[model samples]
Target: MYETEDIAVVILNWNGQDLLEIFLPSVLKYSGDAKIYVADNASTDKSVDFVRSYFPSVHVIQNSENGGYAKGYNDALQKVTEPLLCLLNSDIEVTNNWLNPIIDVFNADENTAIIQPKILDYKQKTHFEYAGAAGGFIDKYGYPYCRGRIFNAIEEDNSQYNDIKDIFWASGACLFIRNSVFKKLKGFDVSYFAHMEEIDLCWRAFNSNYTTKYVGTSTVYHIGGATLKNSSPKKTYLNFRNSLFTLVKNTDSNLFIRTIIRMLLDGIAGIRFVLQFKPQHFVAILKAHGSLYLNLGRLIKERKLLPNRSNYYNTNSIVWSYFIKKRRKF
Candidate 1:
């Protein structure tokens, strides 16, 4: 069985001293004997100093430059020797007794390499968060959705998904994985920089015949978009760009057909945004496609390196399902 000390709660920070001040206490109070780390991404503020001054017991790994999420964690986690790594976000407030269920699941299944807890919104408390509501799932066209959330629709908690289950990807907000598995996957692709890197890593694990799971019994409240707001055009750009990067790198077969369909749908969404007067978001999509084209050769090279498995996705198109069929809640 995995002990509490085996888990490292590593939070990536970047100019978020206020977030650490508010949320770090609850983590210390509830995290049992697990090692807590503040992986500061070279924040210019007093975030590093404050953690050292106040929460001295919390270890600090000072990264040279802000490598965003993917490279920040990649650099910081190299110093951690623990068996389990919990890549907790700086903006999340973890609940009491969150580690026990995760440890139980880890000891129960060796093949389960990654685990994500049920993420609720810190603001609403009763509603599921947008980033990761329950477990996460993806469609054939690389669209991601969750049990309690699909697109912008969020579901209220009613003890419906409070059970251990398999999932496609775990949210980066509070993701857990075996250290060995993480190293085997070589951590998140630094190319992602931010947004959907976890899904790419999870897809890599899935391709390598490893499992990702959702332990709903363990819970955390995430203040979604604390660093990057969901409505920001930059967020739109990264989500769109990184998603194409993920799909190209991990899809099972028919790369050309799948990518063409995905891009066509993205075009439709861009047109919709234009109709809605959200021109910036439309431009973000265009920029996203442009990035994909520039990186396509690299993605193809990377894709050839990983193992491909059939039946990795369930739904054909989450866009058609959520927008046309109006199936809001999963």
Candidate 2:
């Protein structure tokens, strides 16, 4: 059985000294014997030095460069020897006794490869966070929505989701994963860089016959958009590009038909942005499509080598359900 000491709480940092100073204490105080690590992405700021000087007990692994989330974790995780890897974000505030439930779940289910605890909003404590509210699920078109969050409609927590359940993807903000499973799956695709890479990883895990779960008893509060704000067009770009990349590489059935439907739906979103006077996001969608076209050849090649990816979606179309029919709550 997995124990507390077998876990490694590795926080991915890129010039976020302020966030580390604020949130690192709770992780250190309550983690028991689980090793805490600050995986720095070659920060020019004092992130590594500060963690080294002040939080001397916390191990620091300096990556060669700021490879965003995907490669930063890939590079740093090479040095981490723990059986269980907790990919905690710098902006997450983990609570007391968070590790035990995750360990218990891992020990109970041998096939479970990934786990995400209930992520509440750090700013609004009563509400579920947008990133991974009570775990994540994807639509047939590769759009991801959560149990407590679908599109922009986030649900208020009243002990409604405080139960263990199976999930499609666990949030990267605070994710628990088996190190052996991660190694066998070959880690996150570096092409994604950031945004939805965890979903891609989880999708691959699902295809490999491994389970991903959500244990709501273990919870953490995440300061959503701390690194990349929702307002930024870059976030829009990555979300669109990486999502398409993931859809092509992992999803089963007719890739050509699914991609066409997704792009057409995205066109509607771009028009909506135009009507809303957010032209940058519209352009971001177009650029995202262009990148998809450019890399489609390589993506298809990658998919050909992989095994059968069957029954990946929970819903046929989340866009129709959320925007058209207004089934906001998931």
Candidate 3:
């Protein structure tokens, strides 16, 4: 049984009954004594009832509306009293003793404010998942990638990254963060709604001198893109737009230069999408930029309040390195 009273595994839910039916059992079976709660985002279906009926031991926190992931967790987590908050996704399946190693890490270091478990793919099994892979890092221009994933390239889990290490960001798919730190940072930016909000939170934590880490001994399988398919135009828009917002709000230096260069790179991405006959994706990038332009003033004002860390990034240009250099495997 898990010994920690400080940790709570809170899975944010929308209309995900099928996902709960398939994945919830694994979490229940493997999570041991850690308190499990499903924070429902006003799911219209019987997801909350299903949890109540089938998994009565699992607590359910219901919100009044579907506020997406950012506000969904922000609202539900306010009710959780645990010191450590594991913000898990409903589409993830936990392995045996996954919580212990992570809990051990948290117990060891008070400075380690956030941690992400090594995430493998539920479908592929041998491959690392796209969401968080081994650990997450960002380019100098704020494009986030993982140790086992660069862009669309996902590497096989050959135990290459099987060690505890500091990471720039923790994947929200299975993020473990100190509750006090989470609240201190004001949870996630609700304006994000979803997508890249986790990165923004991690960057903020870094600015506040807290560390994010990846504990490789703890592993979970993620069935990513369940709620919003990667192919969806809306998904494309949110990702691109939220990424821009993250860059603007968190970067400590060269804000204008980096933003301009990033926009140019995004334009190149849009052109590539158009050349590939995916005009919808191109248009999605355009819409993302339009949204970013409208919200630039507020984002700039928010930057003034944040402590900008210049050494936050691990690489120069992930776009150039991934595409131009042909460096796919991480």
* Full-model lDDT for every candidate: 0.95, 0.94, 0.93
Residue-level lDDT of model 2, residues 1-330, one tens digit each, is 889999999999999999999999999999999999999999999998899999999999989899999999999999999999999999989899998999999999999999999999999999999999999999999999999999999999999999999999999998899999989988999998999999999999998899999999998999999999999999999999999999999888688899999999999999999999999999999999999999999999999877757688999999999988999898
Prediction RMSDs, each to the true structure: 0.6, 0.7, 1.3
The predicted structure with the larger lDDT, 1 or 3, is: 1
lDDT score at residue 184, model 3, on the 0-100 scale: 97
Task: Indicate the worst ten consecutive residues by lDDT in candidate 3.
Answer: 1-10
State in Å the error of residue 51, model 3: 0.9
Give the runs in model 3 whose Cα sits over 4 Å from its true position.
none
Greater-TM-score candidate between 2 and 3: 2
Q: How many backbone clashes does candidate 2 have?
A: 0
How high a TM-score does candidate 1 get?
Answer: 0.99
For candidate 3, write residues 83-107 as lDDT tens digits.
8889999999898888889988887
